[model samples]
Target chain A: TTPLTFREAPEYLTDEKKTPFDAVAKYNNFYEFGTGKGDPAKYAHEMSVDPWSVEVDGECARPGRYALEDLLKPHDYEERIYRLRCVEAWSMVIPWVGVPLATVLSRLEPNSRAKYVYFETLHDPKQMRGQRSLFSTIDWPYREGLRMDEAMNELSFLAIGLYGETLPNQNGAPIRLVVPWKYGFKSIKSIVRIRFLEEQPKTTWELLAPSEYGFYANVNPEVDHPRWSQKRERRLPSGVLRPNWMETRMFNGYKEQVAHLYKGMDLAKFY
Target chain B: MAKVIVFCVALMPLIWLVTDVVLGRIGPDPGQEITERLGIAAFQLLLVTLLITPLKKMTGWPGWLRHRRMLGLFAFFYAVLHVLAFLQLILGWGDLWATFTRRPYIALGAVAFLLMIPLALTSTKAMMKRMGRRWKPVHRLIYLSAIFAWLHFLWQARSDVTEMVVYGLLLLALLFIRAYWFGVSSLVPLRKSRA
Candidate 1:
């Protein structure tokens, strides 16, 4: 693929120091490739991203398979340097190049019945070793979803590239969602299918552990993960001697932009 | 020579970790790398310390007991380092009080390490002699420490319990064998075996 052309979007950018491209590219949690932080960087190259097609169906007026190029054609890509926080309590400020997910979904004409937007990652056990692992509790295709309003949120993004280059397979090649306020897992990787649903579709992690991984995995330090504290996160490239710990913010510090979306709802219950 | 070799082998993980740290090869998150390595080393040492008794009983070998004290102390050493890495390198001292109060797993790990202190301090021959009647009972705290350590790891396990499960099974097996032997040794009269 030719180098992606994207203009820097000032609104989407954060003043936080961007994590080095090497660390962003090398450290990943794309479990389809493998579970280890470095496994995706090592094995993701084996999975083909070219000749990719996204199947958009369910409660959408235009339900069909769109080639990767066609999906990205109408939208001009923008570089969004957003803080990417993982539920595992590690974070990085990543400059992602993509179109707003709302722009893409609006073009698809989601019908009035569409209450939620469901997504599915590419499934091929031959390519994704984790899919074939007997130890994994996740069902294949790695499904995820967002409530319709959440899907339409301005901050929701569809990232195609990072660091002014085409995204490495380890960091979700071809196309992936970038829900900055939510945990990284909510930003599904290697998308192959998207469905506008009438009901909140069950997500992969939520299915594995409903109590821990709820559908709306917005970054909230107030609510702790069942196993560990969410109060703070270690910024990537942090060393033993020179630690880089920071207090986690509500909505990952995007509360001003996204707080209205969850106004009166009890976050702890939803979390 | 055997003790020296055992000590060197036991120290290898820390050496490798320090080398990795100095060389900047400890991956993207050095704090996590150091803490995990030290924690796992402590756990592995704890398992080894438990294994010595079973091996000696099975083989009727007295030589295995010679290295047990050193192995136990090394376990305590790694455990202390693991705690330090978390408090100093990961959480920082400012957040230590809050983290300890809120996080059960971290508190449990601290408890496990604290349980090792008396065992390590009393490991000396002179101290063991002075506490002769109570030495065995006090040293039995290692069992409680093992339980807490395992609990600490288990409570922190997210979805992938593979590592925790493996460690837990090994611990259970070691404890079970000792429990079984404890029963048999009471029935059978003690006899000095060929050294």
Candidate 2:
């Protein structure tokens, strides 16, 4: 693979202390590999990503399959340090190097009918034991979507590497979406397909439990999950005796950059 | 010697957990990991406490019943640790009252823990003798506590409930064995007269 040429974008960097690279690599929720926090790190190494491709189709003029390199070659990369807050009420600050999702979408030339963008993770039961397990209710090839404007938002990134290196297998190697404003699950991992759609796509979590997980899934402290409060999160690497607990911010502290996109829509209802 | 062995064995999980935390072997989220480990240990001990009477009945030996109080107390000990870990490590004691009121799972777990308090307090021989018949009725709350604990786990499950289902079935089997034995013992006089 050709080495990625990228520059750190000061405008995209967050002042918050970044989570240690080891912690970021070890703790993951990639259900494809497994549901356990450490499962991805333990099992992801077996799944291959050296030769990867993404199928981009639906409501786009330039609908076709593109090699991973070709899709990434045209655009320059930028390093953005963003805070990723999971719906489970845990968070981590990560330094990610990637190109903007808009740059890729615009280049694809989405048609007038396109109102939303849908994304899907690679579904291979042989490689991903979690997909083969009867225990998980998640229908394989995990799906996620964003409104067209939300997709075009500057904060919607498609990350390829993190912490100045290509992504670790467990941390969504090859490519993944990173929407800072939304919950970590909204940032789908190990993506294999992208589609522009007219109607909002039914996301994986929403499909499994609609009441608990909604399509928008914007990080909002006011809207509590059915079983737990979203008001606070345990920042990762928390000491057992001295835990690092912080009040969860609306839009995961990306409110200024992404709030205008929601405008008058009810986040509580959407969430 | 037997009681000492039982006591040390019952204390092993807590000892292991503390050692892991100290050694940095508890994983990335030690607070959450510790909280879950303690909660599961408490639940497992509760199941073991429930098993003692049935084992004594099956084997026609009184030895198993001797360890019941100690095991039950250990379950309560773990439950206390679990709740403290959640309160300090996870919640940081922030808006706790609101959390209890809003999250039914937390409320369910709290109810389970609360039910064990009376059992632990009344486990003393003097208190048991004073309470006499009342003691049995009060001790029956353990069944209710087990149910609440199971529900606490069930409600929090996301998508997959296989683990919760297995636990529920195990709890049901234990309860069924006790109820069946109760029915048989209570009918002993009628059966003897008929014979």
lDDT of each: 0.87, 0.88
Q: Which stretches of candidate 2 lie over 4 Å from their true place?
A: A1-4, B184-195
Against the native chain B, what TM-score does each candidate's chain B reach? 0.92, 0.92
User: Number of the top candidate by TM-score?
Assistant: 2
Candidate 1 lDDT over A1-271, as tens digits, reads: 3487878899887778899999999999988877778889999988999899999999999999999998886347999999999998999999999999998999899999999999999999998877776656677888999999988998999999999888999999989999999999999999999999998899999998898889899999999887667999988878668778889999999999899999899999998
Tens digit of lDDT per residue, candidate 2, span A139-235? 8889999999999999999999998888998888889999999999999999999999999999999999998999999999999988778988878
Backbone collision tally, model 2? 0
TM-score of chain A of each: 0.98, 0.97
Error of 2 at A133 (Å): 2.7
lDDT of 1 at A9: 92
Task: Give me the displacement of residue A36 in model 2, in angstroms.
Answer: 2.1
